[model samples]
Target: MDTTQRALAVGVGAALLQALMLIAFAWPAANIAPRDLPIAVTGPQADLVVGQLAERSPGAFDVSRPADEAAARAAIEDRDVYGAIVTGDGPPRVLIASAASPAVAQQLTQIGQQLSGGPAARVDDVVAADSDDPRGTAFGAMVLPLALSGIAAGVLLGLLIPTIGGKALGLATFGVVGGLLSMEVIQGWMSLVPGPYLVLAAVAGLVSFAVSGAVVGLSAAIGRAGIGIAALTMLLVGNPFSAATSAPELLPKPWGAIGQLLPPGAAASLLRSVAFFDGAGASGPLAVLVIWAVAALTLLGVGALRTRPANEPATAAPIPVTTG
Candidate 1:
């Protein structure tokens, strides 16, 4: 009823929403399942491996064939395939890209051992995660900071600038700088994500720009409520859906599909492409980020137009007509 009461209610609601967000993400994550995982196979026993997988797990794999070991390695490195099974005269060798998806890598190795003569098979990780980060924990950790940085840039800039042009300029600048700085800290200082410095930095910048633009646009359109909504969407919903820890197919039906459609998921996918996959699977994610950035910019433009004062001439002050 009162101002203080309304403010207190709003605060309480935000806190409650945050709790729900944690549950929304944690619940699905606690229950993990691998579905339609992509993999590559080649050589003599390739057909046998595929057949056995079909028999054993039904819909476990989306298998492809590479020409040779070299091609298989390439597929794994570029993330075109998460793991590759190369079958030959001796025990089958499983090549995995642990850096891309550590969980999938472990699964493939176990599968290889079973498929091979119990203890004879070898599991080789071509693009292994760094020793310090054996399971690519750093990959998952990177997304949180990136999302926060974007939100910070958006909220701060949106408050400081009244015009759309000013806000847009501020957000863009922050995206580029924040992106480069974050990469330098993560990769240069910490060696978390190792790749071509320039390319990685560029991808980071693009992601920052998209996230920042989205937040700023949303806030401009709906004031403080916009910021809260953006946080709920990106930080809570988007982060869990992002296939950072595992492949999209590994997640449940609607969730995997939903994550790809949002900014956080799209950005994480783009980062993986640049860092390890040589940008092989970047097109879809890159397109997604582009669309998000464009839409946010449009929202900002609309907000700016609405802020302009009305063109109708002001009415003159009421005449003091006194009947004496």
Candidate 2:
């Protein structure tokens, strides 16, 4: 095709990409609602409250009957449930882990009010988010930038450093520096997270490594196209479905599960675990990040094996000699 035809094609392609991006981002936000959100309930009204919840929202909550208020509190602290309801004796009380998810906490508080047959119900935030970020807005907004940082690091390394070994080293360095910087800003400057300084930094670093490694690995394996693949996966699929702003249950089914598999989602969960839940629910997300990092390294190794270095001296063809 001529230049004008190519320009037109490019314009149309850009428009289509814009449309897809809009749908990817907006669809999840528009359709967000609880889907089997875990919660605990106790006391004499446990069965009745569970019944009401099921009747009202059908399949919205996955209710667990904890033995008592203490058990429910433990569940919330351990990251097993987002919230709990204690019904019996006095007015119903709601236990929430705002650090887990402020959106879920508000939802639980509302539910408690409804169950109480009063305008307000007693509410307690068993594990509250940091005071500076009470609503978790900062925390939620953090994942995208971190993901982008990793992507940028990988892209730069891929372009600037031609050697696979050099790229690997760059990715590791970026991960470490990026993690420390992110932690300093979010924890020290903003006080958004209340976790241990070094631990949070380490977690942040791991996330960075996982994301950058994936991008670098894919680029090494598939040339420039790998960059686009990694960016789109992290941005369109991983960021929106990450559930960073809300609980995984709040996101649409399958997508939420899918997000957890991606670096962004896994990062969010792992960060939250270390920051608020004392690493109670850390294993799964930690494993996910490890797997991603490993896969990226493996891809890098494959690329190294398959790709010929541009700087390598060409092998000399065997000189054929004819004797006269």
Candidate 3:
């Protein structure tokens, strides 16, 4: 057994250990269901109703007693509550914002009705969603744009670092534009991704532009290694850690906490808010995106300054006097 072989074995073992750890962290995090989504209760027996609901489905609904029907509706509208129950003389009525994921709203409605002894329940859907958007589609709406942006960023990083020619830049621009246009056309014309075409396009463009700028800047600063770091941050950590596919409350605490800080996660959340959630509680995600964009731009500027030739003579050299 040679020393080199032993060292190679150790390296492989270490790599395997790291991979396992990452997988362990991400796997369970992905599967855990989001529990205890806020739900407002308003009725003569709101407390009793909430208690019954909790008994039926433990840890599923986090019920809050609102002052009145208006407050309950407002909570749903503000995204403070996923849905609400308002009891009346005949049967309990469920109020769900149209902006919430249809699946969740439906589930809540069914649960509310069931808890109230299967009586007919009136449903009030505020903040109506797009007709074409289907139930459980919110996650897809959020992630698609972020994924496209990441791809664009990777390509841009490749092109910008090597000091590509003006033609290349033109080509790159065309590609980005074409890709985004294609996405819009497919989503709108073909109905590939439900909802407003213009809105989707706008979100996608913003995400792509921000990601590309960040990648270019990072690459400029640290060369090839910068791209690797960017990938680790944006793609590896950001996408999986993002609570798009599953809500943050479902994810393990670590991933949920870290996910909010990343670009894809932030963008996805904002998109979901705008699309399915009716722009409910969107300020936080928007702030995250803004911060990321500003930080990346600043980094890009620093990288540019660092790359400038420090000792280059500014003035044209005076031709040496010819000694005749």
Candidate 4:
């Protein structure tokens, strides 16, 4: 076979290998489930109740028998457990930490009520959410800002890369423009996701800026590797486990537990608090994002400094000697 034919065959094989690897990584990441989330059970019949819940739910819940209600509340407050169930005279009460995810709390309430054989279950939101917030909507707003910011960072990186500057810039521009346009289409035409337009726009802008800055900063620091890492961290790992499409409570255990830490997950929760939940309990996620953005920018700045040309004075020519 000709050398050209061999080269083509090798290139095709490499491309196929890359495609398969991506698919393999994405598949399991998408379907992660929580295995052993810490949970507390309290009250007179706590033992029986915990057992029932464990037996009935099986892999869905792991029950922990806390000493008392105060202990259970403390567990939740400290983020030791995802939730707690408290049994009372009339019906079982499920106490949830609102800071975790309001939707999950509500679902637990419903589940407790069903278990109690027609008696209405009482819900005590130990960490109360802002009253104005709606359920199942926090994830989108929280994720929007970070996702946009990451995109911006990626674009900047592309522009600065020595060989791919023009192409990277073009792609980055398209992503930013396309992302904004998508928001418009979603709000105006589809109406599938609802919120205040002005607020949504603001969120979109902030997220896009932050994310773009991060991507650019990363690329500046490490060149091509930085871009790949940013994409992996921000887009691939961050988006699927984002908790936007499904609240953490609704998701299986594994995905639910780590969702809060991912960039998209953090931003989505914060946005949900602002838009649907009255911004009652979003400080944690907001803080996480601020730290990430600041850190990335710092790295970018240092990288830029290192790339600057060094200052050096030109040496003067030696005095010419007279010929004998």
In TM-score terms, which candidate is top? 2
Cα shift from native, residue 56, model 4 (Å): 4.1
Provide the overall lDDT of each model, using Cα atoms, as 2-decimal numbers: 0.83, 0.91, 0.66, 0.63
Candidate 1 differs from the real structure by a C-alpha RMSD in angstroms, to one decimal, of 3.5
How far does residue 317 in candidate 4 sit from its true spot (Å)?
7.5
Model 2: per-residue lDDT, tens digit, 23-54? 98899999889999999999998888889999
At residue 177, candidate 2 shows an lDDT of 86
Clashing pairs in 1: none
Ranking by lDDT: 2, 1, 3, 4
lDDT of 3 by residue, 1-324 (tens): 799999999999989968965884468554675477678888787877888877877887777888989998778777788788897676788887544555566777787678667766678886555555545464445564555555565556555545423323533464367447855665656553555656656665556655655666576566667766775566666777676655565566667668877777776667667665557788887887667656656766666666567535688879999898
lDDT for model 3 comes to 0.66
- Per-residue lDDT of model 1, residues 22-115, tens digit only: 7878866875667888899999889998999899989888999999999999878777788899999888899988877888888888899899
What TM-score would every model get versus the actual structure?
Answer: 0.87, 0.96, 0.73, 0.59
- After superposition, candidate 2 runs with Cα above 4 Å error: 309-312, 318-324
User: How many clashing pairs does model 1 include?
Assistant: 0
Which pairs of residues collide in model 2?
Answer: none
lDDT of 4 by residue, 1-324 (tens): 899999999999989967866764465446544455457888999878877877877766667778888999877766566678887686777887554665566657777788777667777777654444335354345455457555664665556554333433443454466446656865566453455766565555445545665666677676657666776566655676677744564555565557567667776666555544445456787776667657656766655665544324667999999999
Task: Report the candidate with higher lDDT, 1 versus 4.
Answer: 1
lDDT of 1: 0.83
Identify the leading candidate in terms of lDDT: 2
